[model samples]
Target: MVGQAQAVAAPRHHEQSHLRGLVEVAGASVLWGTGGLALQLIREHEPMSPITISAWRMATAAVVLLLALLALRRGPELVHLARTRPRQLLVVGVGTAAYQGFYFVSVTQVGVAVSTVVSLGLAPVLLTVVESVRQRRAPTPGRLAVLATALLGLVLVSVAGHASSTGPDPVLGVVLAVASGTTYALTALAGGSISRETSPLVLTSGMTLVGAAVLLPLLAVVDGPRVSADPVALAWLAYLGVLTMALAYVLLYSGLRVVAPSTAVTASLVEPVTAAVVAAVVLSESLGPAAVAGIVLVLLAVAGLGRPSAAAGPVLPDPGR
Candidate 1:
């Protein structure tokens, strides 16, 4: 009787853990979605260059993460990353920094909804290709079909969004958004390797610090003397540094402990959707029928990727984690 009782409790415990992880992952996605809204607010006031905003965001995130690491006495773990995974760490750092810098610039030029849709909608396809190449196997026909559909959807979204826009250079915006997606793909690939050896918190903190260091000189050279913006803008920036970038990773990493990596990645497709909804509600951005269809197609593509495949090999590790 006791054995059966214990067995019954075991499943409950596992279910509880899974539920907690799902909640954490959902929270992380929420934080990430808020980042898009925050960036939109930041762009409205004084025109701080995207490079400048990126530099400051990195610097601020590094400080917050570093302090948390120190408080936890995990400074040695971060130092060990430099010694053991120097090259990988550097690549991750640079890729992460470039992704942020370019993404901010792209969002500023193209508006958050279109920029996020293009960048994130295309990231899974890039990841699928990278995983196939890394494993020395070809992606299955189903995966390819999904990729083609997603790409077509992305094109539709971009065309629909651009047809009505008059604010910035559409060509330049597309280039920057694509660049952001490429760097984001690289960062995701790098994170897969790092998460195998290091704690996600340690790796994330170290990379944020390294990225901030790389961006510091550019901040000074490009933005000139930094001046304090309005209190509201600063508050949003603080929310971004603390909640979106730093705490979001913590939640994501914790969630990955219980959830399948593929599920976690697919769940985060919510971030872009959240951004779109927020943009529509807040900015009164109109989405035509084609754009709405594109969004659904992109979501379906992500859902297809979320399923584990024998041909796709092992799931890629969660970069946001």
Candidate 2:
């Protein structure tokens, strides 16, 4: 009776952990989806380069997270991470900064859906290829099929009238979006490599600070400070920095504690979905039937990324920075 009772309790606890993981990952995704909308709001209020917004978003997040580290009495851990894993942290920070700059600039050029979908959708595929190379084996048939489908979806999105009349040049925009995806893949890989040793919160906080440090020169030299005093824009920037950067990442690392990495990736797919729906409804951006079809295909391909890994357990990494 005792043995049976213990077994039952173990499964029950596992189930609860899985449920909690779902909520955290989903919440993170939802919050992340809001970033593009927030940036749009800022662009509405003032005309500034997206790089400027990216710099400030990271800078503000770095300050908030640093203060948070001090408040939590984990300042020493942060220092330790910087000293020991400085190289890894550099990769994380640069990858973080690069992806955001590329994604945001692409967003302004291509509008939300094309930029968001293409950039987010390609990361998993690129990761898959790199993984296949590392393993010295061809990708499994399922993964190959999924990767092919995703590539097709990307092509369809490009051909299906991605450029808005007022949007940036489409050819250049798609190229940047691809670059953004590559950077995101690298960031995810860097995050996963260091995932075991550090507190997710501390690691994330450190990355933000490093990213800010790296980008500060560019922001100061080229962009200068364009922060607006309008309460409305300030409010949105606060949300992007606080909620999207700080809180979303915290929730991600928290969820990663209990959940499998693959599950987290699947849950976070809600971001592009949320972006597409919100953009269509709120921004009055019309996606043609082909684009809609392409979006669905991309979603399907992304779903393929969540399938259980043979031994490595799903490579879809990154606590979604």
Candidate 3:
């Protein structure tokens, strides 16, 4: 009876844990959705360049996360990570800065909705392909269908958003967005490998610290350092750093620790949807019928990925842990 009760409780616990991870990733995506708007708004008040914003975002997040670790008495753990896993930290850190820097530059060339959709929408597709290659098998039909639906949705959103965009250079923006997505996929794959064995807080703190170290130097090469004195711009910068970079990434690493990288990226499909709606409402960026349909399709793809299916193969425990 005792063994049977334990068996029954175990699956239930796993289900609940997975549900929590999904929620955490979803929350992170929502927070990230607001980032483009924040960056745009920040620039409206200050002439700080994209690299400047990216650098400050990383620096601020690093400071906040490191402080949190100290408060939690986990500062030594962060040091241990730095001492033991410097390579992983550097890969994820540099990758994080590169993707974000690419994304913010894309936002400048393209409108927020288009940039967000193209950059974020491309990641899951890349990750899916990588996973299929890693497994040495073709993606199951169900997974293929879901990927196709997502790709179709991403196309609709991109085309519709671009058609109505007033940005200076849509083509250039798209190229940068693609670069961002590629870097994002690589970072997720690297980070996912270690997240399960490391505390999310410690990992995030280390990554942000390393990211800041990488970006701060680039600030000088790009445009020299520019500080914004405007209170409003400062507030937006704070929000971008704290809510989007620090907190959102903590949630993301937490989810990555539990879910497959492909599933985690698919869940983040929510980011573009959230960005589109916010841009339409706040920035007066209009979304046409096709874009709305795309949003619905993306949501459906996310849902489909979350549901367990036979074609997805047997649930294998993460070897990383």
Candidate 4:
């Protein structure tokens, strides 16, 4: 009886791994959610150019990733990947920069609430569309329904919310948010393929380096390449690079090891939730009824998106069994 009880209490390997994946991904989400607030705080305290922040974010993240790889004795592998997979690495890097750049600008424009909602909220759907196209099939009816619902929610939030008093121009903000989502979707596509070929750390590190290269000139042109030496500003940049960029990806890759791909993506929905909550509490940004409804609709669609469609046929018991 004791042995049976112990066996029953212990989770099977798959179940245990899945649970751990959930926890790891959830931790990543929380860290990512802190992103909006972090950026806002940086903007307030650091008051540097947007491009400068973007350049530093990617550059520092790349450096930190390199250091990590060196410590782990994978520096050679990282270099080999950069040399061999230059094009793929470039795509990931540019996409990373574009998404981050767009998101930060969107946050400035519309406050964390709307940017988080539109940018993060829209990525899954965009990814779904891209995947469906890549598979050379139209999205199933369920997917279409989810997309429609999510689109409606996006429109609702965009049209209904009042301009945040301290936020940037809503028109430009919404555009930037959508662009951010688009870039994120594209990045995931490229990053996913690259990640399959190499470890996540190396892929992220390479991409960040490439991203830094691509953003360097842009940063110079955007705000004349300014970086503050204030300890407080450095502190924020460090948190952004080390925690949000580097550590978050480490957790993400760790979670991906044990989680089903779709399930992992679904779990990432927590990021938007975290960002929204943090924005509300820390930034005093409030969503109106329509915006709240939009968020719910988008989340519902995301949940649906994560579920495998049963359009083909139901599973049947084996004849031999």
Candidate 5:
């Protein structure tokens, strides 16, 4: 009787832990979703180039994260990660820097709602394909179906959000946005794989440090040492650096302990949704009927991906055949 009781309690505890983790990941998504909206807000008052904004954001985040690591006495662990996982750390750092740079540039050129929806909406599908290739197995039917649904939804969203105003060439913005997505997917996978063996804070701090180092020259050339001319712009930059990039990553890493990587990615779909809604509400941007439909489809696709697949057995890789 005691054995059965302990077994039942174990699962209940795990379920609760999982719920807590999901909440953390959802919170991270909410912060991430605010990125574009925040940028739009800053751009309204002070006109800054996207590259400049990205560089400052990364550099600031790196400083804040490094400070936190020092405060927590994790500096040694970061050095150890550098020695053992240098290649992986560099890959993640470069990917992180590139994703932020390209994503900001794409949104500035193509508008926040459209660029964000497209880039984030496509990340999971791409990640799934990458995971399958890495595992040396064919994707199962369930994954295929989810990918199809996600693609269809993406098409609907793209068509709905089409603009006639001829902003920066849509083709260029789209190509960069897709590249950003690829970098984001790679970073997530690499982070997850590395975090399995190391402390999340250490990994995050090191990556941010490396990314910041890479962006310093670009920031100097593009912005010429002007971090921000206006107080509001400075505030937004600080928020992005401290809350969204630094703290949010720490929360995300913590949440991953209880959530599967696939589920965490699916949950992050909330970010784009929040960004679009904020744009519509605060900026008074019109999404049009097709955009409404696309949003619905994207949300549904997210839901479907969140559901457990029978073939995969709750997080198991599907059989190759």
Candidate 6:
């Protein structure tokens, strides 16, 4: 009876832990969903180029995270990560910068909603394929079906007439968005793998520092390098750096420690929905019928993932346990 009771408790505990990881990943996505909108708000006051904005975002996040690590007397961990996993950290840092750079540039060409959808929506597909290849198995039919549903929704959001019209160059924007998604997928895999042995806070600090170092020099490439002086715009940039970059990523890496990279990215599909809704309410942007339907499908797909299915076999075991 004691052994049976222990066995019963173990699976229950595992399920609860998995659920917490999902919530953390989803929460991070919600914060990230606000990013494009915040960037848009900053542009309204300063008209900074996307590259300049990207540099600032990374630099700001790096500073804040480093300071926090020092405050906690965890500064040595950053050095340890740099010395031990230099290659992996560089990949994550450069990958993070590249993805955000592509995404911000895409926003200039495509507007907020479509750029957000195309970039974020594409990550799960790429990551899922990567996972399947790594695991040496095909995704179960149920997993494939869920992926298909999510992709269809993404397609709708991307091509809807009203959604496309907001961008000056939708085609170029989409190309950049794809670039963003691909880089994002690679970064997620690297970070997720590394998080298994590292603290999320330390990992995030090291990555952001590398990201900032890589992006800072690119500011010169911006046409004018317009830095915002407005208090409100500065505040918005702080929000982007602190909330979206630092906090969101901490949550993300934490989730990745327990959740499979593919599933973690899938759960983050909530980002586009959050972005679309924020755009509609704050920017008065219209989502149209198809776009609305697409949001619903994406939400349903996320819900489907939360439940047990054949795909459950692919889920990474809870690493912390």
Best by lDDT: 6
TM-score against native, each model: 0.75, 0.76, 0.88, 0.72, 0.80, 0.90
What RMSD does model 6 have?
A: 2.5
Q: Which pairs of residues clash in candidate 2, taking residues 3 or more apart in a chain or in different chains?
A: none
**Ten-residue stretch with the least lDDT total in model 4:** 310-319
lDDT of 4: 0.68
Q: What is the C-alpha lDDT of each candidate?
A: 0.69, 0.71, 0.81, 0.68, 0.70, 0.82
lDDT of 6 at 303: 72
lDDT-best of 3 and 5: 3
Model 5 residue 132 distance off true place after TM-score fit, in angstroms: 2.9
Q: Which ten residues in a row have the lowest lDDT in candidate 3?
A: 310-319
lDDT by residue (tens digit), candidate 5, 62-92: 8988888889888899999999999999998
lDDT of 2 at 67: 92
Question: Which residue window of length 10 is worst by lDDT in model 5?
Answer: 312-321
| lDDT per residue (tens digit) for residues 75-149 in model 4 | 988889988888888887888788888987887787765776688667766666555665688766765675677
Estimate, for each residue in 1-321, the C-alpha lDDT of model 3 and write its tens digit: 999998997766665566567678889999988987898899889878888988899899999998898888999998888888889989999999999888878877887667767787788878877878878988788877877787677667666766655479989998999999999999998888878779889999999988999898886677634787899999999998999999999999988776777778877877777777888999898889998998898778877766555112223343343
Report the error of model 3 at residue 277, Å: 0.9
Stronger candidate by lDDT (2 vs 3): 3
In the range 97-128, model 2's lDDT, one tens digit per residue, is 88888887776677755776678767766666
Question: What is the clash count of model 2?
Answer: 0
Candidate 6 local lDDT, 1-321, one digit each (tens): 999998998777666666677789889999988987998898888888778877888788889999999999999998999999999999999999999889878877887667766777778888877778878988888888887787777666555624435668989998999999999989998998899889999999999989988988887667864576799889998999999989999999998887777778887877777777888998888889988898888778777776546232254556777
Query: If both were scored by TM-score, which would come out higher, candidate 5 or candidate 6?
Result: 6
